[model samples]
Target: MKVANKNIVVTGGGNGVGRELTLKLLSKGAKVIAIDVNQFALQETFRISGKNPNLLIRVLDITDKESVFNFAEEIVSSLGHIDGVINNAGIIQPFIDLKDLKFEQIDRIMNVNFFGTLYMTKAFLNHLLTRPEAHIVNVASMGGFFPFPGQNSYGASKAAVKLMTEGLYSELLGTNVHVSIVFPGGIATDIMKNSDITDKAASDSEKNSKLLLSPAAAASKIISGMEKNKYRLFVGKDSKIMNFMYGINAGFATRLIKRVMGSKMSMEA
Candidate 1:
């Protein structure tokens, strides 16, 4: 579905790719409602957008199902209707193996990454079905399909999102509501800080990496995918390459990632 002149909602719009998505949507003449848990970050995004009238920023925590449903109701009541929703809000676990990781960390990761997307999707789906053309975009991760050492739980949560989105696509096949699942590789963003993970090894590795995609470029790809109603989108060159590698041999791909990322994770633990 075309986004121009349509009302689209993007979660986690305060920072990172979500912020970039909000800005780009505005540029495309879409009425954007950008929601994030961080009020200050939402303000920053608003300021960065020059406080565009077409952009609306709201502070929301997607993990809260009741609040999510209420917010969806409010948006439709106030704005008349919504054309799309991009579930982009998520957080990663600490750089620790599953055995050593605390249960709290796993719960938080699942709540925000998987359940949060579920709530948001369920909340807006009915409204989306009412529109002539509507879209639902869920942002999973490359880890969702490939194994990453010290991020097993995080990968699992995203993997759930991946399947859930795919299922939604199948269920809505003949409907006006289009579903798209996105698998994004490494992107230049403050995810470590945002996730409240302070691992020096992980931080150093990400900081020195030159291969990560920029948030703006990632957002552009996501929007383009949405416009075309793609069922699945791989956001970065690394994600695309890894997807192909995994398709060839899942065992080899898993071993390769463990060999590369395990060393860095060992340094942290």
Candidate 2:
């Protein structure tokens, strides 16, 4: 897809992947509408982006369906057309087991990740379908394929996205609308810091974060895949490695991962 002049919306366009993506799109000359729940973060992104002519920010809560629909209406009223949507808004809960997980937390995760994706997709369908070739890219995670301990809720939400996006792709097979899913292994961002629900202790010796890929690196990979209209793309070498390992022996590998990560968590605790 030609990068310049295209209309694009990127959710969670604040201080991490979203921020970098919005910046890149603007640099490429795309008209961008950046959406985020935190007005402060959105403002920070704008400040960093430095008054681009092709950018707008919407401070929004993705879980609010009414707000999303209204926001879509507003965008259509102004832009007249939307060429693509990056369903990138998502939340990760504190590392905890299901039994220890609060009902509120689970609801928050589901509402923001799964239902939010649905709401955005639904809200923008008319606009996207109107275009001859439109794109909807949903960011699932490697955890979607293999459940990660202490992140069961997050994993479940992303797994649903994986299936939902695939279903979307198949459903729109004959239509001009194109849907793609992304499964990033790990990308270094303040995601964990942004997601920390409450005060927690840390181990003295820091272990390397699994999120090894930088946001810029991830953005490049994403844009590359979108250009080819690939159905799915993994952002990191580790993502591909995980895919292979999981595909080869899911049961065994899953257990092995759990053991390893569990050991780390235990040590940290």
Candidate 3:
């Protein structure tokens, strides 16, 4: 379904690609309900977008199932219907090996990245059904498809999202809702900082990598994928290349990813 004139909900709408998505959607004449845990970032997005009537910002913790359910009802009551949803909210794990990571850290990553997406999808699934046509865009990562050296827990969470989205697509094949899973490679965003990793050298190395796509470009590709109802969308050149390379030889891909990233980090697993 086209985004124009649609009532869409964007999770993680506070910053980065989410913020860009909100602005882009409004520019296309869509009414957007932007949800984020950070009120300040949401305000920043509002400021950047000029706070049009088409944009509504809400502070939400998507990991809280009850809160998500309540927000879904609120959207339905206020907007009459929801035309689409973009589950763009997710967080990465600290650059540490799986064995060295604490259980609390793993749980938090799973809660926000996996359960958060599930909650939003369940909360809004019925509402989306009532629309003439609806779309569900779940942002997974290349890490989900091809493992990253230090982001094991994060990758697992996103992999869960990727499979769940694909299952939804299969189940809703003849239904009104269409599902799209996005695999984004390195994107120019503050995810490391957001993840609270203080490894300045690691951050600098990542920033210096040639593979990172800009947030605005990633948003455009994502929006275009939603409009086109693509089953699996690869956002960056890195995503596309890695996906193909991984498909050809999973073992080789794994070794290459580890070789490129493992040396840069201090980890135990």
lDDT of each residue in 36-95, candidate 3, tens digit only: 999999999999998788999999999899999999998899889999999999889887
* Highest TM-score against the true fold, candidate: 1
Q: TM-score for all predictions?
A: 0.95, 0.94, 0.94
Off by over 4 Å in 3: 199-209, 266-269
Top of the candidates by lDDT:
1
**Of models 1 and 2, which has the larger TM-score?**
1
Task: Report the Cα lDDT for residue 154, model 1.
Answer: 98
Ranking by lDDT: 1, 3, 2
Worst 10 residues of 3 by lDDT: 198-207
Candidate with better lDDT, 1 vs 2: 1
lDDT of 2 by residue, 89-159 (tens): 88788888999999999998999889999999999998888897889999999888997888999999999
What would you estimate as the lDDT of candidate 2?
A: 0.86
What digit string (tens of lDDT, one per residue) describes model 1 on residues 1-269? 89999999999999999999999999999999999999999999999999899999999999899999999999999999999999999999887778899999999999999999999999999889999999999999999998887899999999999999999999999999999999999998888878999543245566457888878999999999999999999999999999999999999999898887877667856
Off by over 4 Å in 1: 199-208, 266-269
> How high is the lDDT of residue 184 in model 2?
89
Q: Whole-model Cα lDDT per candidate? A: 0.93, 0.86, 0.90
Which segments of model 2 are wrong by more than 4 Å? Answer: 196-211
The TM-score obtained by model 2 is 0.94
Can you rank all candidates by TM-score, best first? 1, 3, 2
Between candidates 1 and 3, the one scoring higher on lDDT is 1
